[model samples]
Target: METIPSSDFFIQFWGVRGSIPTPGKDTVRYGGNTSCIEMHVGGKRLIFDGGTGLRVLGKSLLKQGPVEAHMFFTHYHWDHIQGVPFFTPAFREGNCFHIHGALPADASSMKQHFCERVLHSNSPVPLEGMHADLNFYELICGETFKLDDITIETRPLNHPNGAMGYRVTWQGHSVFYCTDTEHLPDRLDENVLHLAREAEVLIYDAMYTDEEYSNPKSPKYGWGHSTWQEGVKVAQAAGVKRLAVFHHEPNHSDDFLDNVAIQVQEACPGAFLAHEGMIVSVV
Candidate 1:
C-alpha cells in the first residue's frame, strides 16, 4: 500500500451526500450532508465546495479563530454553493476567502449564481453585507496555480454545467479531488487520467451503484455521476494509490454505503467511502 507524506497535511470531510442534503433517521450513519471537504496544508486551510456541511465547518473554524481560507468550487450547483452565505468565516471582517471555479462564457459570472439565488431563492441571507474580503476568480481548465507551498492543477470534468477537478501537490505529496463527474469503465479522459496519476489520494464522485446506474429508476443516468464500479476502473487506470469514494446518494443508508465500500474494496484494494468527519493525514 502507498502511504501519505510526513508533512502533517490532512483532509477532513464535512459533508459527503450528493444531489441534496438528506437529514432524517436513515442518514445519520454515513451522513446525509452535502459536498464539503477541508484540507489543511502547511498550516493553512483550503475548503472544497460549500454545501450544507459548511454550517458545521464554519462553526469549527470560528472556534479555531480567524484564518485565511480558500474555496475551490467544482461548479455553481446548489448543493455545492448553497453553504457560502452561511459560512461563519465569510461573515467575519478580517477573515478572507478566495472563490475559484469554472464559468460559462455567456453567463454574467459564477458569482451571479450566488447573488441570483438559483437554489435558495427564498432564503434571507445576502452576500452583499458580508464583512469578509472576498475574491472571485474564474479559472480556465488545465492551468496550474500556486497557493503557498501547494501547486494546484485544474481540469474540466465531464458534467452538464461543467466542473473542475483539482490536483494539489506539495512537499512530495499529492491529492486529487474530482467530484460530480461521470465516466465509463473502459473509456477515460486523458486530462482526468493525468490529474489522478500518482496521487496519494483521489477523492471522486461515486454517487450511484452499478445496478442503480443501469436501472430504469435511477435518477442520475444523465446527471453525470459515476458508479463505484466505474470509479474503481478509473482509479486503477489513473494509477491512483487510494480512492476515497464520495458524493453518496441522498437516499442511500449507511448500511448501503457499507456494502458499497466493501464492493469497491474488492474491485480495488484501497477504495473507501467518505464519511462525515472522516479525516485522513497525508503526511
Candidate 2:
C-alpha cells in the first residue's frame, strides 16, 4: 500500500529463508535461498548479505555488465556468506564491489574473512582467483557512515559471533535491515528500536513463531532468531510505517508463512511476510 518514486527507491528480496537453503516444491512459492536483499536508492546499487540468493543476483548483474556495487554483510555465518564464491560478478574482471561489515572475532578484518572462506581447503577458487576489484571495510557497531548519497547507521545485533543491523536513508526516506537477531522477552531492543524509529520500512528477523521460541522442551531463546510477534512489537514501538517480516525459518512452508502473515496483519496492518522477488517501494 506504500510507494516510492519509480526511479529512485526500491527494495527487492532475492532470498528470504534463514539458517539454510531449502530449494524444493514446498518452498518454491516463498523461495528457498537464504538472506539476500537488493536495494536501489538514489541510483546507488546496494546489496545486503550474500547468501545463496546472491548467485542468482550475480547472474542478473552479469547480463547488465560492468557492475559497481556495495555489499553489506550482517555477519559471516555460513548461511549468510556461502554464496560469495559462486557469485558470477565477483569472477568478472570489470566488476567492482565494496564489502562492508563489522569484523568477526575470529577474523582480523572483513577482507580476512573473505580470504579465509575462499581458501584452497575451503573453496575451489581462492580469493586471488576472483578478478573483480573488491574492497572490504570493517565498521564498528553504532557507527554512522555514508555511501554515495545514502547515509547508513549501524547497530550491533544479538547474534552469536555478532551481526550488524543497518539503517539506510536517502531523500528523507529510510529503511532498516535487521536480521539474525534475538529479542529479549518483554522488552524491545533499544538498538534495533533506535535504528528502526519512524523508518518507512523495517525488514526484520522473524525466523520463529512465539510458540516455537518459547517451547520449554526445545527453547531457542539464544539461537539468534526472533519471532513475528517480537517483530510486530518492535514495529509498533518504533512507529515504523511498514514491517517486512524476513529471514524465514527454512522449514516454514508457504502455507505456514501464509498463516503467519494473517496473524501479523491482524496485530499490525502494515506487517507482511517478505517473499523472494517481491519489490518494496520505500517512500
Candidate 3:
C-alpha cells in the first residue's frame, strides 16, 4: 500500500464530513471528521481547511519529524477553522507552516480571524503556546501563483460570507478542491468548470442530497452547500476524469451514504463519496 504521502501528486482525506463532527456507530464507515484534506505535489505538502480532521492528520505528521507545509482556508466557518487548537504539529518548535487565505468579506484579516476567533484567549490553548514558524499570506481570489513548477489557481465560490476554490496543477495534471459552494440553479458555474476542465481529480462539496436540499419541511436553501447530483453535473460538463464527492452531510449515516454512493456510481461510474482516510492520486 502507498502509505506515505510523498507521491509526486496525490491527495488524502483526513476528515470528510461537513458542518460538524459526527462520531457514532452509524457514522463509522464514512467517518465523522470535518473538512481537512492533505495533498502532496511537487515535493510540497499542501493542506486545505482545518476542520477536526486536521487533529488526526497532525498526529500522523509527528512521526515524520519536523514539518514544513502550506495550509489554505476556504472560509471562516466554525467547522472549517475549529481544529487549529488541537493540531499537535503547530505547537512543535521546529516546524513551519505558511497559512494562506483571503480576507473575509467582513474585512477581518486571516491572522485576526485565527487569533481572535479560533485561538481565543478564553480557550485553554493559546496562540502563545504554538511554537511553529507560522507564516501568513494573503490569497486573492481569481489570482494565480506558482510554487516552483506547480501552478495554483483560485476562484470565488458561491457561498454565504464567501469561500474560495483552488486548482492545483503540476506536470499537466490537475486537481480541483471546490467546497462550501453552491451551484447555480440553471447553469454550471464557469469558474468551477475552468478549474475542473479535464482535471485528473475533482474533490467537490456535496453536503446534501437534492431532496434534503429542497426538503419542504427542512430546506437547506442558501446553506452554502451543493448536492452530489450537482457534482455529477459539474464533472460531466468539465470532463473531469474522476469525481470525489465530498463534504458529507452530518446527518447522513454510513448506510445512508452507502446508498448515496451507489447512486453516485450509477450516475457517474467513476465517482465515489469521499471518506476519512480515502486517498486519490492525481499523477
Query: What digit string (tens of lDDT, one per residue) describes model 2 on residues 1-283?
Result: 1233485888988889999999998998889999899999888899999898898888878779699999999887888877888898898898999988787667877777678753325776778778999998988889999976799999999998789999999988999999989998767899999999999999999999999999999999889999999999999999999999999998899999999999999999978899888888886
**Every model's TM-score:** 0.91, 0.95, 0.96
Q: Predicted candidate 3: what Cα RMSD to the true structure?
A: 1.5
Better of 1 and 3 by TM-score: 3
- Using TM-score, give the best candidate's number: 3
Clashes by residue pair, model 2: none
Best by lDDT: 3
Q: Against the unseen true structure, what C-alpha lDDT does each candidate score?
A: 0.82, 0.88, 0.90
lDDT of 1 at 53: 88
Compute the lDDT of residue 183 as modeled in candidate 2: 97
CA RMSD, predictions in order: 3.2, 2.3, 1.5
lDDT of 1 by residue, 64-157 (tens): 6666888888887878876777787877888888878766676587677545643256656666667888877777887999987899999888
- The predicted structure with the larger lDDT, 1 or 2, is 2
